[model samples]
Target: MRRGYWLILVATILLVTGYHLRFQAPATITAEQGTANLGNWDFTHQGPVSLSGDWLFFPGQLHTPASFLQTLQTTGGAGRAPQTLPVPATWNKLYRHQSSHPLAQGRGYGTYALKLTGTGHSSLGLVQQPACTSSRSYFFPASAPSSQPVSTLGHVAATAPQSLPHQQPVFSALRTRPGAPHYLLVQVANFDHRLGGLCRAVYLGTQQQLFDLQLQRLIGQGLTIAIIFSMTIYAFAIYFYTPHNRSSLWLGLWALCATLYFWTRANFWEQAFGTGGTFGFAFHYTVEYCSLLLMGPFIIYFHHHAYRTRYVAERLLRGNFAAVLLLCLAVLVTPVEWFTRYYTPLMWLMLAQLLLAGYILLRALHDRQKNAVRLGISALPLFFTIPVDLFANLNGKPSGSYTELAMVFFVFMQGLVQGRRLGLVIVRSQHLSDSLAEEVKHQTASLEEKNYELLIARTALEEANRDLKALSITDGLTGAYNRLYFDRQFLIEWQRARRERCPLSLVLVDIDHFKALNDNHGHLAGDQGLKAIVSHLHAIFRRASDVVCRYGGEEFVVLLPNTSPDQAAAAAEELRALVASTPLHYHDQEIYYTVSIGVGGLPAPGPSQQPLDLLSAADRALYQVKRDGRNGVGVADVIAADIRA
Candidate 1:
């Protein structure tokens, strides 16, 4: 069964991966020797083409379109010749004259120029998405009369301060004349991040095709984020409503952090809120670092709760959380350049976290812990993807949708595990309820026989009779006093209250929408909900003289000695609020419920009045509360036969 389940999960992952790959635009032609000849290419048929391969690279120079054109014309291939470097690669990887050392460091600025030849006169669109710290591109069309670029993205400067970094994607339309070469110049500056120059692919297509592609990418990212956020909400709901499950809380926090991290990476904010300035840039990196750092600790915390290696896991969790806090603090206080230099260290830290997680999982498996295999199955995707993502980040490459898809699969598996656990709990509860009912019946008969033979019974028999009597009067499921006990106790309390000239109160509580809960969530859930409400009743009315009883299904009665009608009403309101606020969690599902409380008391009972009158009065008030909408407290003074809310 387990092997079959795993096979199904793997198949689902492959299906999702295939769906993600379907949207990717494939490149057919590669630019060589600083120029791409597209004479044989058809833009309408090919969709979009990637401008990847050798491009003219001018190290340490930030050149404009007009200046570069003038320089090339004036120099006429003189001493200041440009080198051919691969597009979609950082300048830090560029070597000088067969030397091992790089030609330029990551901190410097540079210009990249690409020439397009043999393209027929057709209106075209260019898309550039640079993953470096910052960049600006100028598109000079062949049909233009002047040296000025027809379209420009931001303003690239020689110095860091003068540069306005364009982190968002840029799209430009070109009107190309027949039999002319077009010049595309991109100037990049990187004073902050670890990689400079064109790190992402540039594409060319028709204007509408590029726009449609961009829209599709945005929609895909938006849908993925939406699914992650929904899972976050579900995890949080379980954490808050369930009795004890800190794992869900950490899981929710981790999902939230992952969502925010991906959102910024996708540059969705730029589309929604427009171009990000200096503040936006800083905010982006800050959120990125904080979210990434926090995710590790959050996952560790989640694993700590899911599996028990607490002593070691607890120490690890504390250290990781503290380190994350310090790193986040550094990101907030220091300049982007100063903090970004520690990217290698951050990567190492993340790697360590991954190793620690592996250790924990191994330890759990060695110990033969419950649900260990299931957890391993769920975590398989993350274990595979995190390393791949880390490698991509290290190499300045764009990460794929593997991590997102993995998270989706992980959440699905978690839901399945939780559902199975809930099923087990329900089955166990039903079995226990059945066994307890049979035990109670047998004990009741024994108690009756022992009472008749008390003279013949020994001391042990007397004690057993007492234990059986106690069990007979108490509810099997909720452990509250039963209705029979309440009936006899209520009369005794009423007579004593009348003799002592003191008030005696009765608070009747009923669970609202109980039948609906049972119908929707099943009888097992209803049984658990009943027990939860009874627990609240016992907690609130805990005086030694007070008696809590399960009057019937989804209805409970509290006998408060020396409590007035007003006092009982206040207590009932407190109980009502408590029950309404605390939801019953069955696995991933949170079931919220409320109670209608009816308070009835005799402040000074007349000689003619009976105990049944008080019960009748409380029932009437309960009816009134139900009629006036449930989840509220209503009061009735039996002496005056008046009811109030």
Candidate 2:
């Protein structure tokens, strides 16, 4: 088929899809007035109710929910997906006129308002009421979070009021009998971006329900991840599989490093699958950039097209790599909200990346070379579509399927080009029989030598990897187990202690006014000071079981698997005095840095015990010591007693 025909075919499909989405009917439900009244309703078990009919009216500003979705899906998409919204976040955000979470592509943005009115319980609280846990059909008995029971509406159940703010402000002073229609008024509208949005409301007078929602903001995140993965694969292919060898081997190796860093070292897997939180959120957000950084060398290698290309591309590549690394470090070493403002800096970085890709593609197009043009064309859709896709999702007009279709086209085109080129080369190879045989022999011998060397390297790598993994747990400066290692060891030790019913002590060591020392001298001198103190801590960490690491830039954590608070304090005090006595000379000032230590011991460690809580208790004690005076140790329980007194 002609390529033009393919384009026309795809265009027809899109038009048909859009036409289908543009018009759709609203599902109707019978109602008495513009209201509904019922008691003890459960949406979770019953799912979305179709309350669409004559009395079931929406304000003129907004269309019915079912009809609205129908129009959107038919015009812009198919029932394949309805753009997801972030659920369980602050409702206060929903009211903003232009407020939008990340949606499909960068091109989309706006806000929509939704309101529901019924003459019934407006008392559903903001706190997540548990969905029905019982397997009963349609309904269950009413109950409260407390041990007490509550009223029931038909088979539907309502829970007693707890210390939760009412989620809905609408008032309802009415009731309904079986088959009798009631009134319901729902008003919804969007202020910007074509007034495009979703306004869904449910009145499940009765039925079983399950909750399903798209975390809209999460779509931007998922798209970013998918792009990183796709781009990485492309880079890997360019470096390892492409006929161009100007710098292929090195580029491939760097791509491998980036892949490892993204998957393992950077904690992308942890955030997506493991524990989700500030750490998860932060990692999840930045891992894409880290992956990009890792993929940079190959981008540069391929961007230059050959070693013969200008020095500036190579220089720019290094500069970009360094900037990314600095950004990563800055994020880690600095306080939150400084560099992570979500919009400004992040948007700028995304813009920079777009420009870079644009320049490469434009340059490739101008070259008039087949391979260069092919490479550029292969990556064109991704470069244009991914960011646009993110912007749209954030704006509530997502097109994930369109993006996937573009990607499929790219892969197919690239594969065809590569296969054609390889086939031609194979047909031309018969003329150089002697040369080909010699080349094969040389390659075979080289492969054998490489295999032997690889075997030796593999053994050495395994042993080194094992040791490095152990050392990774240890804080480099402190020569003790670091936070990452401490976390792993803490779980193991805590479980053992729980099983054995034993005590565990944790101490937090904060250097009093260490920041002042750095201010006085310099960061380099301060680093040396920390190294000296870590050396001391290392000497004291005698038992194989005890673990310690730099908990904060200026703080250290010590874990005693089985020790009392008193014992922990004694250890802390000894380290403090040793640091005080061991003064170091930095710059003109012969600086002395003292340590303020807080010690805490668990009466018993168990699954329920949080290691951070123990650290927090120690931190509170350390605060008390700092208040009393610097250069001292305080135990959490002891300090608590003194504070009480």
Candidate 3:
């Protein structure tokens, strides 16, 4: 019975060893595997291991897993000595020292072979594709048939990944028997003309860990999409409210471009368009190229509006648009080879745009435009990311969507800046409105005061005008009615007397030898004498029916409305006697003066008699008085029927 138990135990040990050999892989399959130590790694404690060691590189060759296995069976993959290249390093740079190599800096198919040792549940992943076109990765048991595939990872998509929002890397799951060897083969035959090489480290881990990692990536991508979509809608809404605000429009466009780019690079379009058609591939790359081109205008105009560079901003924005559009059109119409050949140079254009944007932002900050300071500060992340992305692209590495992440922050900060600026503008507008209202109030009060002053001036002017009219009809020297007043009165009195059949008489008085008095006593004494004579005339012609005026120099005329020639002659004699008796005080001397007087009358009404007829008759009588003797009165014996003065 003990012998039987020993046999059973040996059988059990043999079965257990056989099962372990059939399912689990060895810890070290070769010298290269020992260096990687995949079996020794603790899957639960550690992250994915880097397959960043030396790889046997074959250039200008297209080999599938079957073909590679067949070749390996024939010669153990040693027919031609393979070139050595480091994973996670650019193949272009690796061959840069070997200028004679046909694949050096020249785009073509390349196969990379490496050995990995891990348990049956291991998974393999090429975390990044330098250029995502016509690339494939495979993992299989080294001893397995060439026709069978352990696992296969196809190219993520034929989409360009220069811009943000690209698909996640493809990870392959593989199983190997215990103590058995396995191999990893990565084949890249990109038609895209770009620097060819591994940009990121390859990762090897358990299937569960890879699943968890992919789920995490999926979550990250989803969040990126949601953030970009929400921002796009928000910016578009802002643009709708302020249709003239170019910044909001550009921001919306920027977000939209980012979303489209992400869709293609992330292989979301693959599910819709599938990865087979040329159109899908072209469309994917075209979206990427267009998005890259759009970056310039969006960034430029955003700051243009934020900085208030309205004068030159629109022109620059249109120019940027035209340039980007033309370039995108070229990218679309150009052949694949042409695009690939110029892809790096095209990427360099982004550098130019970045530099230009930096200059514009810096200039805006320097000019002290409102919000420019904040916008510039917000762009610091983008500025840092630009050079990093540029270097990464040139070296064929994965930069992810760092620029897009920076843009998200930039957009948020810009929104805050715009909101703040709007609030300030509203405050300023209210203040200005209040100030204008106060100014209007002051102006209205001033205008009312001016109107009151004008009314007062108008009243004073009317009173002065009346006084001026009186002065115009009065003599300046004698304070008596002028000749013009006498002429007017003479006509009225003459006509009235004719209608009444009453007598109208005219009495004329002259200062005797007034010229001699003026020449001897001076004009001052003469003026005083004239004034004294006028005063006596006023006393003599006290009746309301009489009119008195200074007819000429040193002469006076008095019209008596209802008096005869006899009565007028008596009045003239009285005026002559009064003037001869009166004395005029001139300066310090009292000067005595004498006068001659004449009287005439219109005895009855006659149509042929005029006002001048009485004056001429009176003048003739006055000459008689002056000829006869000084200081006397004379009456006309007859009035002239027709006389002209």
**Which prediction has the highest lDDT against the true structure?**
1
lDDT of each: 0.77, 0.48, 0.66
The local lDDT score (0 to 100) that residue 401 gets in candidate 1 is: 88
Q: How many residue pairs collide in each prediction?
A: 0, 38, 8
- Each prediction's TM-score versus the true structure: 0.66, 0.35, 0.55
Tens digit of per-residue lDDT, candidate 1, span 1-645: 356656876776676666577658656468887789988888888788888899987777777776777766665567565677898887666542334433355776778888888767488888888446667666765445344554444456667787655567878887777678887887777766667778888888889888988887887777778767876887887765554778878888988998888888888767778757666777777888889888888887877788655626456578779989998998999877678778878978988887777777778888888788988888888998988998888777788888889887887687666656555655765565555445554334425655634533332333333545767898877778999999999888878887787888899999998999999999999999987887788779879999999999888999988998988988888899899889899978988989998888888666777888888889999989999999899887546622232
- Candidate 2 C-alpha error for residue 469, in Å: 41
lDDT for residue 528 in candidate 2, whole number 0-100: 81
Instruction: Give candidate 3's whole-model lDDT.
Output: 0.66
Residue 471 lDDT in model 3?
A: 60
List RMSD in Å for every model shown.
17.0, 29.3, 28.1
User: How close to the true structure is residue 105 of candidate 1, measured as C-alpha lDDT?
Assistant: 53
Roughly what TM-score does model 3 have, to 2 decimal places?
Answer: 0.55
Instruction: After the best TM-score superposition of candidate 2, give how far the Cα of residue 213 lies from its true spot, in angstroms.
Output: 9.9
Between candidates 1 and 3, the one scoring higher on TM-score is 1
Residue 111 CA error for candidate 1 (Å)?
Answer: 1.7
**Candidate 2: 10-residue stretch with minimal lDDT:** 131-140
lDDT of 3 by residue, 47-114 (tens): 55556767766666656667766665565456654566766666677778888876576455677777
